[model samples]
Target chain A: MSQPSDIIQVSNPTQTSTKSALKGGYNPSLGPIQLPTSYQAQLASTASSKRNIYDHSLSRRAPEVNLSSLSYIFNVMIQYSQKNSKGIQELEGKLNTLGYSIGPKVLELITLREGKNAKREIKLVEILQFIHTQVWRTLFGRVADELEKSSEADDEYMITDKQPLMSEFISVPKDMGQLNVNAFVAGIIEGILDVCYFQASVSAHTVETPGCPNRTVFFIKFDRDVIERENLRFHK
Target chain B: MSKSLKTTGEDLWKNKADKVNSELFTLTYGSIVAQLVRDYKQDYTQVNLQLEKMGYDIGIRIIEEFLAKSQVGRCQSFKETSEILSKIAFKYFLNITPRVENFSTDGKQFSLILDENPLAEFVELPDDEKANKQLWYSNVLVGVLRGALEMVQLDVEVAFVGDVLRGDDATEIRLKLIKILKDEIPAGED
Candidate 1:
């Protein structure tokens, strides 16, 4: 246990802590599969000398790519979504759905990787802080600039990212009013929240500031039941 | 022939490109391929085609940035083109310069032996025979090469010949030049 046998080394990009988990017998590339508690020990051994992505260690830092490469791929995804959808809402919905699936995988990966100190958060503020710090840091290389509670609403919280990467190059056409690509980011937050037992909906909005033209605010609204649970567990 | 290109590539990757974590990019590509597979009902051939088409779209526009950033001149022969590809083009974008060897006697074809592939980093193919045999996990690279070459006025066919993800000994992408196309002028406009 001291040697950190679970510690990884292969430049592997997975977020999970154990061996690679697969839904199909061979891989998990086809669709979103609900991961079991120890997703790492689920792989079947192969007879071939060759190895799969799961054979590598999951403990190493994830790799990096050129931002331009991501931007180009994002453009293609938008185009494809636009071609298939009838209107702006549907298109954003598709993009959100695409990113939503990524949320759980990331949560599992980051949580397990946190080692023994990691716990299943019960309090609402602590979990949101975890998202504001750990989740954002792991995904985007920096903590979100601000995490604030809405003064008028008890169940609402806001996480803001100045110059959001996903929307950096996306200038929605004049014809399409009020479409923010960061809706995909909001979906990711929602996915994580759902897995953590917090029922919520998340949305992305652009509120430009004096010098920061690309500022994005991810607005998260928790369900009434969740607020009630938090009040019962923590306050009482 | 390759040392200068390698230096240029390494220098550009070190400073010129604005880098982002590869996890998001890798996961994003995996999600797209998965979505395509689901949409097609596991008909991997169609998924491969869609991936290639998408890569081709990226290649055409990305080549402009490649040209502008690399500042290299027109390649006089296919040999030079392959060198630029294995060295500058791959490094400028992906940060890996694959080994270019197995040249054809006529100098029209060669294969890029990818020592490392960041795209399929965490990928493990499905056990289904249909998927194991039919799917080209990194088929998008094939389309990118073809589209980028077409813009350079060189008609070429690009495809994956061997893949490690499929239990093959190596991962190799073969490029064959069909013919150098002439830049044609309109019938009456010229």
Candidate 2:
């Protein structure tokens, strides 16, 4: 499966030294930096030089990224995590920590990508939705399965992903019952919550809701301090 | 008004057909051995032993991407990195971050304490003392962390300071910085 062109043959040290001497410091006589003749001709052929330049710049600036590859890796990660843990709660905790670790960084990356378009979400509901949609999409290449408001409390909410990539092939053994394989996703949720400045403990569990097949509810119990701060923000 | 659509579990199951069952993890292990055998012209037995060693190497490579994608930043200190290793790194990578406490400072050097290590959450050491001493179920973590951190240019010694499986209340993994390595400057025209 190897290509001869891709072999990356490392030449002798003497050859590198010789090449370095020939490619000495930049010459002042080279004049103001100019495109090679072929590139110049190509640029001249375009109808609108401005539009061509804009298109060229845009193409160069866009990073080549693959989402499916990320999903595959996430699939393996979930399997690996499941294999290491002995019980369900332990596995979930592991997943949560994993997600938590990534939360701050993911938030930073997303914010960086959004640039001026990014807005800080002050409200709990808005923040959770932002995580479910924006953050989720940026990382997972798709939005979450479900977003719901807590029936009992104003500050509580649930972000359900019918199939979290991490929990793709994880079938928890019967011996270690009560463990949800999607704990890593829960950890990611928890990380998002914390980074967004919502102090809350997030847990992932498989809840047997009669009508729901992918009945994984991310139980986000907000920190009392967060609720108090929200109240203060509202009153102000 | 029409309701906003949501991707259901059924939808995910339906989509599974498109995902190629590459057996990436198992295949990766196989590929490493195959490469090693071809490169060194080693026998199958030697290749198998080498493959087991390469598992830790693969873990190191995998964990680096895991760390980078997770967005974990440069740790403030060795202690901070240790906390992160148990709390965030372990959690994000595996979903079990060890609970940390019992921090003891010896002026120059400091030690972090751990409670309830999820890797060793339900594990127990063997009954025989000799057998118990040889059992290091979570040893892969030490090697993986060492390799991963080294790749990022942090020279540190990682060891299993304690284990709950051996009747301790918590499992303690101690990381001591041996030296500070220079950072890798990105290559560009900037």
Candidate 3:
């Protein structure tokens, strides 16, 4: 973890004497940048620190958005994809591609908040749990319903999140055959998987679990190559 | 008095539960379009001509947030960014981070292993073959990332390396960081 560099204080030498009576207040340049108005006042109020502390304090007060907005956008995305698509498979493909595109950007944003304390996840299981909990919470406002190890393979796992936000109001028409309205969600999962540098296969499938209203399982199978690398990392 | 109070109640009910309300989407779309028109001196007709144009606009800003929040510094190579992308960025933002398992000796090539994919939760591929070809829903993602990264001056070729539709065991996106340009800080002094 790298410590943030010292905050660069740009003081005007000409005004240094005039401002000395003010007890070396905030450097004008260091004043809150063009943050959203909602956050500007909060940042300004907390901007009392003379140097690096003020910068860190401002960054801390930065606005964090709720998952509802993303959910609303995703709902429209589903409608848009449905309107534009020719059939079910094409929609799924489209959603997957969409998820792929957003994956890298999502990864970047999440890691930035972790700052220097963030560590690279070396173990396969640990990374999986991280995704099931942290990624799920950030995007969906709740951790996955369950995380299960594959009975058939040691390297495989299943993360289930019932009532995913994208699927909240969607009901796939039977006539559309096997089309899942939640393909967009699958795309997001695909994006996360790809960004995490997991060279594995992931597929979203509907499983009927008794008493569970929205039982959906994301079956993730790691490539043999991944297994080999995990082995090496474990031994090392 | 009863009728007037009833009308007010009805209005509140409608306001609170209007599912078909396009206001949020329209406002977001409108703001982006307006900005484009102002920035490029284009007409409103041209602005309405391309609403998807706004996706890229949002992508550029969103990507900057991702970079700042992730605090990913200059990587020695694109490959390193790939690893950081999977482990740190993916984990922090979306939570379902991938594990880099398969690495070609060249270090330029590797595979990301995903165990949990949140987006895929409750997802099922449509069974119709025709729908598969016509609906390229996921293509927007490729464009979003491409546009965002390009704006940041990281010219990289991104594509879905593999997919379950292709009968491959796993879905994979192959991102080849083609070039890292010299950091040209934006025109206005930072």
- Tens-digit lDDT track of model 3 for B100-172: 6556566655555544443332222233443223322223334445556677677766554544332345556
lDDT of 2 by residue, A1-236 (tens): 25432222122324433332111122344423333444445435542322211233211222211223334344445545556667666666755666676677567657766788978888887888888898777655578878887899866778887666545545666776677756666676787788778989888777766665446778788998998898888868
Candidate 2 chain A TM-score vs. reference chain A: 0.63
Give model 1's docking category.
Answer: medium
**DockQ leaderboard ranking:** 1, 3, 2
Worst 10 residues of 2 chain A by lDDT: A57-66
* Per-residue alpha-carbon lDDT of candidate 1 for residues A172-212, written as tens digits (9 for 90 to 100): 88788678888878888899999999979998888889998
The true-versus-predicted C-alpha distance at residue A176 of model 3, in Å, is 2.4
Candidate 1 vs 2: which has more DockQ:
1
Supply fnat for every model shown.
0.64, 0.00, 0.00
Report backbone clashes per prediction. Answer: 4, 15, 41
For the predicted complex of model 3, DockQ is 0.02
lDDT of 3: 0.52
Model 1 Cα lDDT, one tens digit per residue, B1-190: 6788889888888889988877777777776787778878999999889989999998888899999998999998899999999899988788778999999999999999997888888787775667878899888888888888888888999999899887788899999999998998759986
